[model samples]
Target: MLSAAAAADVRFYGGAPRRRRLRPRSCLASPPASGGGCSESESEKARSLLVERYQDGVSKRYTLDGNSKLQVHWERRESAVNTVEEEEDANSLIPQAVKDFVLPAGFPGSVSDDYLEYMLWQLPTNVTGWICHTLVTSTLLKAVGVGSFTGTSAAASAAAIRWVSKDGIGAFGRLFIGGRFGTLFDDDPKKWRMYADFIGSAGSIFELITPLYPGYFLPLASLGNLAKAIGRGFRDPSFRVIQNHFAKSGNLGEVAAKEEVWEVGAQLLGLSIGVLIMDTSGVKSSYSTLVLTWFSVRLLHLWFRYQSLSVLKFRTVNLKRARILVRSHVGHHVVPDYAACNKEENILTWERFLHPQISFGVPMEIMFDGEESNDMVDRLLKLYRNEKYILFVKPSGSRSAAFFVTFKEGATSMSVLRSLWQAHWLHKNLQRQDEVFTWVEESVLALEHGFTDFLKQMEIAGWDHNQIILKVPKEPVLVIEHPDQEV
Candidate 1:
């Protein structure tokens, strides 16, 4: 029933910890799709009792004691704890230095003007990215004879008309198509005027720009925006007490169906000028020109988005296009979604950890939207509805920060939250607030084995019998790794 978009995995790291030992817990698998909990099997129970003899770096043994209790013996902090507790503690990468905060510290930068100046620097960056991507893609396309110049006016004119169709149809589609669909929402009425005003502003901008193009493309562009505006009006209900307000009237819900008819009057005026320009130019579009136009559309779309902040995506999507190509990229699969990023729009651009696409041999840099972990967890929960998920926890310390988790896939982001919300895991496992301890990131132990080695290292590093909380990184790098691959 709630709006959906994010959250996956069971691994989570955060501030604070609980001093406790791990015990037999629920299996990693989600309850049988029936909204019911699943029980641990006998083999799973027996697996818990087997004595684990560590052979890598400082070797040790993990075994259940005579009283049927888990016990651990390591070089430092020897105490028996279950797999789950160890997995959760692996999250802690204690910061070496805690930074202080005070006034005029609204931004992390030394001065507010510095941040503004940095943003202004991005305009050149956008132009650069657009140039590079266009060149590379054009080169590749040409190599394959994708869009070559062919001198055939009859075919060229048809190509031009065919090429302009999506945008042209979309322009008209926005109004009636948008208006008809807008009625589905039953939002507050007072907010309608605000949305209407925003739409009008967007429509005005489009109208101003439309005249630059020819008859077919210009009106379609403007109309498309107006249709979008009409749709927006229905989505945003008006809360204004003045029922007499014209915008709240929702006239026929058409793009031209504004409270004041003059709104459309201005757009039509622009459209007329565009029609005149198309007739005067009388230029015919050749096949080459049509192909160029198509590529330009895709280029502008991606560049415009890159010009903005970060884009969001889902885990299940099968996107073949990679938006970025970082030189030393750390790619992975269990990435955060748009909802997790708390972005207003659900932009479906594959924001690969690929860093940025190289333009002029320099890494493309854009604005970084590293929303804090609290905000991330808050917004991400809306995406999961009675569905079980998993997560991989990558600490935010250094470029080579060690991957922290016991499971091959890592810990679940929701499991930690679910425990708190459901009020079950901590109490059941005896995690007291006073007993938790954290391992500083300065101490990245080199273990020999894989998941088992991580648990042993935590105990060997003196985090034994202590539930360490791994604080979620503000900017978590979403890169999946191989089971044996070093992170």
Candidate 2:
């Protein structure tokens, strides 16, 4: 008889008894008590049977639960894993260099719709008028110098002269006649030679009659006055030669005509002066020259000066505006939420108020949920630290997909909070610097969601589960640090 203790021990260590073997008929008629020892052969046989039963139980459980089969089925279904592995050969789509370069801190709020409309309407007209005026003035000056004033058919020039003259003859024509005797004849050498001669002669006159005009008898006396008047008149608020002249005449049509003429005259004068200075020095005048010497001189001078002046003015006044506009444009690329808001009308007003707060170069971090392993997390942290930009962490199973950590300059956490408060409380500063983080948060989530969908679609297309990282939405928490700590 097998001892009870030994039988129990065998059952426990080896396996559960088989249903057929556990039957009463197969058991010993009288089982031994707890202390009764069994023969060595019986004990060994019992152990062997228990071991066989245990193996059989394990085989039954695996088949009934379907665990092994499911694993094999999954392996077969995921045949596209190889393809996904091939695709992931490149680490990230964003270039390492681009990732290394810091992104701008915040979004430049959109230009208001109204301001954009206004700029669209106003800038083109203003720029066109300025350009046309320069062209006409240059042409007329050349015509006058070459004794071919009649040849210039610029309607604008004629209108200017008629407007300026008291008796309806243009001021230049009247002045020409008044100073006719002192001036060299039209047939005289190019205006450049005459200018040099005049300068030499005027030097002697000034020495002889120093007290007559006092300090005004220099070569530039007449030309300088003209240039100064033109520059001042165009830019000065109080100087309204065209407007005032038209008002006094009480003729709207005449005013329009004179405005055109003045534009032409100014252009021509600048051109003529420039030609005399630049082209006339080395080139000698000749009879019957195919090129209209004076006209050519005037055109060249006017074109050169006009370009120079326009460029200078653009640099001085509009360049800053242009730069701000460009910054706004480029900023849109970095943070896209504000792109639609940057209309011209809005820009016109918003730029004035908000441009100062905006600065460039902010850091950003993107963390994905599937990368929750300790090693992966460390790698991401290392990547963020190496770049020296703020890290945004999105944990798995989080509602919000993005959150910003600290960056070097620009929006601090408090400042961002403040801007949010102000935007909610005050008039919407669409171009506000504070909104940059907000926009960044939204944009990252959007990108994350997009990446997620892309991965899913890839899976559906027969990709392996392990081949591509699936993005999971994670709770975003801001990690604040002391100022002394390195970001």
Candidate 3:
């Protein structure tokens, strides 16, 4: 094995942090015990012990006796000699190159649940660019003495509001109207996508693109595209699926490079056009004309691209968890409790589903004991008096009998959970069957973090830990991970 110092040392790129000392990090195979290195025999012994310990960790599920008590024994499921299967997967944002990048310590944990904040601050990328660009341009115009602002009032945007941005009221008015109108639609991904494409496309063009917008319309186009991306991401699960595809195998460095150059090149193009317009039109204010028009477009374009990169960066954050959660073996897989869990090997991939339901509202989940249901659906609907609840995460993988149902906003959480539970309880008993069932309230953060913990808990057992699925099949279960707590 290499020395700890040698293993920790890494050359920085392009003189970055040249003088700043790198904190030592080590991947030592064994805990440090002595003042010096262990003998060759001792090292070999440690290696063997590690192998044995790792093998032991891949334990099977504990067998339950007639009284439902744990038995210190193993009961293996029949090997799937003729069939093949695969594991479930969580979505990621970018390819492996950017996957190495770490997320902020308090990332999704710190992300707010305020819908209005998301709409105003995060949803519209072009608006973000527009606000930043207007402020910068108006200030610059004041410095050069271009438009109406005469004396002390010039520096502030409030004075140059008419000249620089006579559009905020209309834009904000439309935003509020759209939010109100959106309440009419139910939570259907297909319907949501249709609305997003039409609305987002129209909004981007109307709100962002000026007639002489900089970069010869390329920046405008980029902003429009980003707006669409934001819109789709807001309501469509498939939007995240596409983002995850970019993260899984796509090169983020190349993407970042292309976006950076696109911003700069587009801005330069706008500047050239502005200069041309000044020369051809014989405008007396040539310097002011070029600076005001082209610079504003370019600056806005750059900011738009910057905003886009920020979104991609968040998408990249998911990869950090995958590094620890996923483990592969030759012709097999590894997880926490493999001995008692499903060990059937297959060529099928359960991760990539075509129709992934994305729920934006608060969710109540029910895992029933049926393959497919109509009577169950009708019964549940009649029980709740036809209050709408969308089907979100379909129960698949090892536990394929369950289904996830989410209650929309304004629905009482306790009432929803209670109704679902009571119905399932009575239904199971009346059917005279010991069917597995559960009902729980879940959120986006809760579901995702639960999956994260599920993967990690499985990892603790061993590589072939498929036999030990982390989601304990019991009702009223909550798994909470500490914020900022080290895994």
Strongest candidate by lDDT: 3
User: What TM-score, over all chains together, does every model reach?
Assistant: 0.21, 0.18, 0.25
Q: Quote the lDDT for 399 in model 3.
A: 34
> lDDT by residue for model 1 over 1-487, one digit each (tens)?
1111011111223211212222332322222344432243422442221111221112112322233333322221123643443454466453212111111222346456576567568869976875665456544544455555453334443444443443345445344433343322222122343344445445544544444565655455646555554634443433121222233346444433443376478679867965664454332335444345435544564455343323322211111111110000112212223234223222332222222211110000111113223222212222221222212122333332212222111234323222121111111222323221112110111111122433343344333222222212222222222122223
What order do you get sorting by lDDT, best first? 3, 2, 1
Q: Kindly list the per-residue Cα lDDT of model 3 for residues 1-487, writing each as its tens digit.
A: 2233322212112112112222321212322343343345533332110000001111112122233322221112222421121111123444322322222212346446664356455548876788787777777766766544555654455545644433443344344433333322221222343445455655466334455565444445444544554454433443333334355457756655665697699789977976777676434456456445645654575455334433331111111112222322101334324333222211122212211212122112122222354234323333333332333233334432233443432334322332232323222223312332223222222332333444455457553332211211112111111122111
Assess the local accuracy of residue 485 in candidate 2 as a C-alpha lDDT between 0 and 100. 31
- lDDT values, one for every candidate: 0.30, 0.31, 0.34
RMSD of 2: 32.9
- Model 2 residue 53 lDDT score: 15
Report per-prediction Cα RMSD to one decimal.
24.1, 32.9, 23.2
